[model samples]
Target: MKTEDLITRLAAEAPATAPISGGRVVMAGLLAGLPALALLLGLLGVRPDFMAAMAVPVTTLKMVLPAAIALLAGGAALRLMRPEGRVGLAGPALAGLALVALALVVWRLVALSAPQIPVALMGRTAPQCLFLLLGLATGPFLAVFWGLRAGASTRPALTGGLAGLAAGGAAATLYALHCPEDDPLFFVFWYGGAILLSGLAGMVAGARGLRW
Candidate 1:
């Protein structure tokens, strides 16, 4: 085919432009996940002493940290939708959060006796917390994935990982409402593990699902 003819055909077959931006996709993911998350919350029920629990500074951190991560990581994920997008502040911000979490975990570890260390790490619901957070994050993660399909991300794995981080963070925020375990040892370890796993899952999904 002639060069001009080939160009014309390619342009005609090109995909439609995305309807929204990456940041919006992150928000939409949350919105899409809300109903299902709410239903799950209803089944689990919020902690009875929520009001009292919130009074504790550590308990408040449990909610705030995850929510902050969702917002920040979601922003980065959305930007990655564009071919020209870079990591920008997302890397540093995430590292900062990690350091903060690690410090908190260390502090908690110091406060606990040797016997308590094992018990603290293995909080009352060790298994439950990990699975519940991962399950809860799935809806939002999938939603974000669907939204990102409208985009043309060059770095699918990174984009998906960020989206997963956002989804997991949001789920953790909600889970904190029901989880009475306020200790950093438990929340940081279990919640972080769940979010990391979510990121890994996202990486795999992006590798397979985002291909044109």
Candidate 2:
């Protein structure tokens, strides 16, 4: 075939543009995940003391930190969906979160006795926190993976991992309502662990699912 004829045929067959942006996809995933998360919360029931506890800075921060992480990670994931986009401020955001957690720990520790330290660090739900967060995060993670699947991400695994981080962070925000453990140390550890685990899972999923 002549070169001109071949070009015309290829152009005719080219796909049309997508209807949505990466941000919209991420938002869809988040929205889709919300119902399941709400059900989980309803089933688990919010802490009886949550309303009164929210008055405390530490308790409030428990909700705020994960929400902040979700926002940052969502922004990163959206950027990562583009073939050439980078992770921009997400790294610094996470680092800042860690520093804040560290400061909270230091502040709390200065006021507590040695005997109370262990009890504070290992709240009654310490053993269950990671597992609960992971379970809560699963639906959101899957939804995020679905949302990102059609993206032309150069680093699929990394993008997926960031999506997982976003999902886990959202889950943690929901979980905080039900979690009575107000210790910063516990939040920093178990909640962080759960988010990390979800990120790893996303990495693996992205490697497999996001492959073009």
Candidate 3:
């Protein structure tokens, strides 16, 4: 067979529908996890005083920080889905946001007396926060990863890590409504730890599965 004819035949055989965009894939992933996250929230029950707590800047900041991270990281993940896409400002933006969080944590730490430091850091729900944040993020991560599988990503680990961090951050934001731990020290360390853990898992998975 002539090479031109063979190429034409293969092109004709391609699927008629256009593949979904990375933004759509990320949105779909969020939708996919909504029901599960809702169920988890229902089971845990939102803290009765969430509204009041939200009115407090310090307490509400816990939610805002994670939501911001999710937004930025999710955008970065989509950008990386394209072979030609560069991370651009996403890396430095993420770093600056993280630094802001750490600075808040440090400020909170200093505000506490020496004896109160340990209790504030540990919080009553430290372990539960970690487990629930990771668990809630699982479905989103899997959905995002599955959706991105067909993309010609040149930076798989970064793509997957951002997706994972996005998933974890979103879940953590929702989880905050249910979580009683409002201290910057506690959530910054434990909640941030959970998000990073998700990013690590995605990095490993991307290394194995996202390679073309």
Candidate 4:
């Protein structure tokens, strides 16, 4: 067949409706998750010193770190939705930030009095951090997965996992406002672990659900 004739024939058969864009899908997921997060935050209440804490670098970093992770992961997820897309630097970027956080914690702990080490590592809310983060992330996870369902991701598992990271990271950012645990150690262990767990869940769900 002539190339021009074939092209014309294929174009005529194309579906009239345009597929939803990745940005729109992710935006919808984010919107879907917002109400749930806001409601949860309302119930839990923001820290009394939230405004004051914002001036502190340590306090600010807690939210900054997760926000960065969410941006990177969400960007990656959007890219991965395209069949030819690659993860690029998102994974490494997350690892680097995590390492920086860990190093800071270790340095701070080393300089602390031996007795302070325990207290710093085990902040008052350490136990609650894990559950709270995961709980808050639940809505986003479901929302993002629903968004992923509309995408034709070649790397479904990876895309889902990134989406999970985005969701968890976002939840953590908001949770940081209410979380009184300012110690880096607490963040590195609990906050980081929770985000990882969310990614793992996404991986499993994507592997099972993102198939064509």
Ordered from best to worst lDDT, the candidate numbers read 3, 1, 4, 2
lDDT of 1 by residue, 1-212 (tens): 99999999999999986466766776778687888678767898899999998998877888888988888888888887777778798899899998999999989888999999989898899999998898889888888899888887898888888888889999999998899887889999999999889988888898878766
| Candidate 3 residue spans exceeding 4 A from truth | 1-9, 15-17
Residue 80 of candidate 2: its Cα lDDT? 78
Per-residue alpha-carbon lDDT of candidate 4 for residues 1-212, written as tens digits (9 for 90 to 100): 99999999999998888765877867776787787678767888889998888888877888999999999998898887777778899889988988888787888788889989888888888878888899888887887788778777898888889888888898899888789888777787788889989989999899888878
As for candidate 4, its clashing pairs are none
Q: 33-141, model 2: which lDDT tens digit per residue?
A: 7776777677888889998999997779888988898889878988877787899878898889978977988887898899998989889998778887888888778
Please report, as a residue range, the 10-residue window in candidate 4 with the lowest summed lDDT: 18-27
* Model 2 spans > 4 angstroms off: 1-9, 109-111
Per-residue alpha-carbon lDDT of candidate 3 for residues 136-158, written as tens digits (9 for 90 to 100): 89999999999888787899988
lDDT of 1: 0.86
Per-candidate RMSD, Å:
2.0, 2.5, 1.9, 3.5
Candidate 1 positional error at 49, Å? 1.4
Better of 2 and 4 by lDDT: 4
lDDT of candidate 2 at residue 33, scale 0 to 100: 75
